[model samples]
Target: MRDMKRIGNDRVTSIGLGTWGIGGKEFPDYSHDREAIEALRYGIELGINLIDTAEFYGAGHSEELVGEAIKPFDRDELFIVSKIWPTHFGYDSAIKAAKASAKRLGTYIDLYLLHWPGDSFEKIKQTLHALEDLVDEGIIRYIGVSNFDLELLRRSQEVMRRYEIVVNQVKYSLMDRTPEETGLLEYMKKEGMTLMAYTPLEKGILARNKCLEEIGKKYGKTAAQVALNYLIWEDNVVAIPKAIRKEHVKENAGAMGWRLSKEDRERARLCV
Candidate 1:
């Protein structure tokens, strides 16, 4: 709740709940439906309004869990993001996927993204056109893409002249710095797009880093919190770390409301 990043007209917490595992048996570690629901609800109760899910996740089970977990909250208060699978990249299939995801989420999607680049430019063009149409029809508020490199992102923007691509979700963590190394982070900032960092914890590796732990001691936070804070400390970036346990959710929330010094941020970058 402390670091709020704006996506289009919506302002959401820099720290969001990711539902990749909550999708069900597809992820062996997240088979507990009840715990997943409880953790999501607990996150929202703590003012975490950004929830990221996808139709491909558990073949739509993740959206269903998100739908159930968000039932008690005002729909307008949350920013729900979902994605269309790469195989569904086309005018018709993309539209169908968006509608199906919305139905499962039990609300209009705040932002819908193309999960990845298609095999052909024509295919990508068709999918972007469909997303533009969905925005026109009010099925989705904004359009975006994920796992795109610099050229694909540029091409996607050129193809969709009607609406701006507001976000680019990718795997970025202390361990995986490819986005920054390849200048994708700089390009995104230049184009006014939010870099939605998925797997910001590197699947728990950075959570146990000795460098992050040392940095966290100064802030009275955990290494995981320090690692997460490093991601959201910037203005044009947001980190969505998945947590299916109440205790983990609380720890994730603790990453907010504090700032890391410039030296420490640089140290983290070098250490990782």
Candidate 2:
């Protein structure tokens, strides 16, 4: 597996396996159950220990597949992260959702998160509290939030300060530049919170960016590698780029062995 990073007290692979394609409703479903299991098995062979999914992905079909795929591997070597949907915001729903996710995953989740910051702040707070209780009860190792803005992050942190909230899952990439503009990157880095970069390849848009192409040519890398490297080299940031192809999986992992110089960083920042 690629080198791991410490999120609070837990160790996770730097380049995680984004499970959306294998499990997402919008993406092509696996041709058959074996394809999904084989893809996950391939990811493990490549040292991708972190598999990111949500209860919403295939309505839990993804986690079920993940569980089945990783059954032969040592559970401790994998960093499994799954999310709870926003509709399940109240304490009861939050608790129930966590149990359901755990049941479907067939293993304890390494991290659980609030999928989004929906309308009810009180319900969100109750859900965070319930997650904290789960951690205490040894049901989950860490708790976090996703798709939250600065104000929501501040609000969530107020509740989570007493607990162990280590990461925030968000859409971040060279093509989607909002996270940089909104000051969430700075806030997250300073708070000792890891930024789990979902859609870090911009849903495949960065591969078409001219700026990325130019940078990739300079480094002799693909546009996707350049975009992913931009996030991987930044402090306190990790990305989960989905890939089922062996060549693409290795291409994603290849971004890890180099340092983006100050000039490269400046060029990438200009694109953002």
Question: Model 2 over residues 1-272: C-alpha lDDT tens digits?
Answer: 36667788777777888878575564545565576678778878878788888898887888888889899999998889999998998888988999899999899999998999889999889999999988887778899999999888898888764686688899988767677899998888888999999888877787677787788887888878888888878678889987766677777877776767778867976865
> Which ranges in model 2 have alpha carbons more than 4 Å from their true place?
24-32, 270-272
Question: What is the Å distance of residue 6 in model 1 from its true position?
Answer: 0.9
CA shift of 69, model 1, Å: 0.4
Positional deviation of 19 in candidate 2, in angstroms? 1.6
- Model 2: worst 10 consecutive residues (lDDT sum): 23-32
Predicted candidate 2, C-alpha RMSD = 2.0
Highest TM-score: give the candidate number. Answer: 1
Overall lDDT per candidate, in order of appearance: 0.90, 0.83
Q: Summing lDDT over every window of 10 consecutive residues in candidate 1, give the lowest-scoring window.
A: 22-31
CA lDDT of 12 in candidate 2?
Answer: 74
